[model samples]
Target: MSLGRRSVVTLAAAVLLLGGCGGGGQEAGAGAGAKVTVEWWNIVTTEPLKSIWAEKVKEYQALHPGVVIKNVPIENEAYKARLTTLNQSGKTPDIFTTWGGGVLKQQVDAGLAKDVSDEVAPWIGTMTPASLQAYQFDGRTYAVPADIGMVGFWYNKALFAKAGITAPPTTWSGLLDDVGKLKAAGVTPIALAGKEKWPGHYYWAYLAMRIAGLDALEQAAADHEFGGPGFVEAGRRLKELVDLAPFQKGFLGASYNTPDGQAATMGNGKAAMELMGQWAPVVQKEAGKDLGDDLGFFPFPAVDGGKGLVTDAFGGGGGYAVGQDAPAEAVDFLKFLSQAGNHREAVASGAVLPVVKGAEDAVKDPNLAVVARTLASATGFQLYLDQAYPPAVGQEVNDSVAELIAGRKTPEQVAQAITATAKSE
Candidate 1:
């Protein structure tokens, strides 16, 4: 589906506003004896996270008396487009948030981002090897992780209880069984917002990971070799789930905003669960629901004899990176924000999982804590497809998945589109 008019207007306004801000150079705050200004951009849509990030910037400025931070809160779609323009024009922010893997690699290749290896290596020793590896490319580290998250089932505990599901499912059959029970109890087995496309794509990616294993899926995404048995099996399994009537009715027409309208269904116990990222709690809070006792989380169910275990998750987190053209003061400001105190504050206030070691101790929310533990225990990390491939190729994958969901394309057709893009790239 096309973006709403309001969204289009907002994106246009953001681009014009940012464009009028002029190319990178000295601004009002950059003068003799003035504070060093660092422009930082992020795509945080929810309330608590928005405030938390604002607070973090405030705290960073306080710690570095002579440094200033200009926090630009851009809408998600606009943020990517704006950053791309800035990167190409050599006017990117001094320090900005970036998704792990190919997203960062693209900027690194274009020489828009700085190699922060020396600046972050000492602290890197404390990071999970897999987490560190997610942002690394060609033996150089270009970004420092801000958090790690996982894709899982975020369910309503009370709904599960009312449906007589005593425990979360750990296997494919168990999940299907639970879905049946939930449906029989008049609850929507799953809440899916397919209009966004990415949310629907998550289902396919997670299913692919479960069926094909991390290595094979990564190879497929990286090399476009989806002809392997594991890859085909993944497509078949995802098709099975799609045919199960698991999603809410008219899901293909539902947008992320639909969840808010359907809040009563989920929050009032009409829907059992949603397969989503760790940010569900944040979304719940924004929807005006007291998610206290109702919320519970569990990893996606396992596939029998699958090379990967049930605990393996499919999601990507972001990190902070300084622009190569940033001034010395901007680099120093980035260093200040990376300190343990600032990072912890960001997590505690925003409910974000910290990328640094010892930062988890400060995450108070139960769900965030669970996410932190899951990420820490992860044996491998798969960068989200959109973030793992070049933007053009990533768009093809998303488009193919959307077409498949709309019944305009088959699994083989989608897989072939992906392979074709890989070959051309």
Candidate 2:
């Protein structure tokens, strides 16, 4: 789902490499006067994380004189390629950013990630389980969860009024009716960056979760079969909205961060809403005119007879994992970084959505706070499928779902195509 960030990751031709605390040193000390270096690779190139992370590292290092923390903030796409190369070369950073889905699973499967289950157990209960969902596999944990968030509809309240939608719908049927009303009022009902197939896949993914339950998704991935009735039904529901032609003009090929893309369409009030993650408002403000107080948010509506609860959430967040060969100091540094007090400082930057329990109060943004609270109490949570499955299988889901959205495939066909890919993987 790009975590539904509108698929803005920039793929680079080459990876950025930086020299870290190395040179066959005995160790970068972590204990006072005991030098031990922890090479940490992360992708917080953007603020407030970029600045906030550096400050936290400094604080951690100050507390442990001999501990030198090397922070490397890499770009997203570059990180992926570079990490793949590192995995193939059988080397890993002491601590590195991870999403804890297919990629991390592969890394873990290949024995590249450290088993932090025991390390995290003592304080694990202090954090919300939903925030740690992606990092756990077969009752074992492999990473330290940092931030957690979900995806839903972000809409313009004024536009809703203009279209006579007194309130956001709470059911799938009501939502479809609202879409029809918006279209009847001649307003572009929705904004979608179809060029980024990940955005299109969210519709199918969420619907599947609502109808089949989160377990169904995990089961499908395990069984390498998406031919279940719930999978087909999810495609059908998505097709219902697509058939209504609810999206913006030329949305089929619209780029997300471009001047005239999905975020801009909603930000500029040319469209009523967009199905996106917590970062929706940020992108809206950046790419188009700010909607400010006029904007509102709501979870995806519940489907009738669905196995999933309305409180179920579908999303994931950026996290960090210890490498198989990283210095023990790396895990300690991560623990320091995730402390309630230290993590709360990041809330002020308005870039991160906190994962640590008791830090929700640090969130001052109204819309984001709503999301945070909802996630805190969510009855179930599912990480984005693309991030939760093998890379090949994940891409197949996106491609197949997009083809379904573009009117080029049927629900059954979509399910079959994805199943085929999963089996191949």
lDDT for 10 in candidate 2 is 18
Local distance difference test values of all predictions, in order: 0.70, 0.83
In the range 103-180, model 2's lDDT, one tens digit per residue, is 778788888888998887787777787888888899999998888889999999998999899999999999999999
What tens-digit string does per-residue lDDT give for candidate 1 at 1-425?
Answer: 11111111111123432452322344575567766667777676667667877876787778777766788888767776687666556456877777766667767777877888877665667666556666788688887776677778889888888789999999887888888898888888887777777777776777778878887876776676666777566666666667778877777777664444333345545568887777676565555465687789898888887888666767767667778877666556556656778777877775467766767778787877887888777777776777677666666777888787777877888888878887887
Each prediction's Cα RMSD?
4.4, 3.0
The C-alpha stretches of model 2 lying farther than 4 A from their native spots are 1-34
**C-alpha-based local distance difference test score of model 2:** 0.83
Best by TM-score: 2
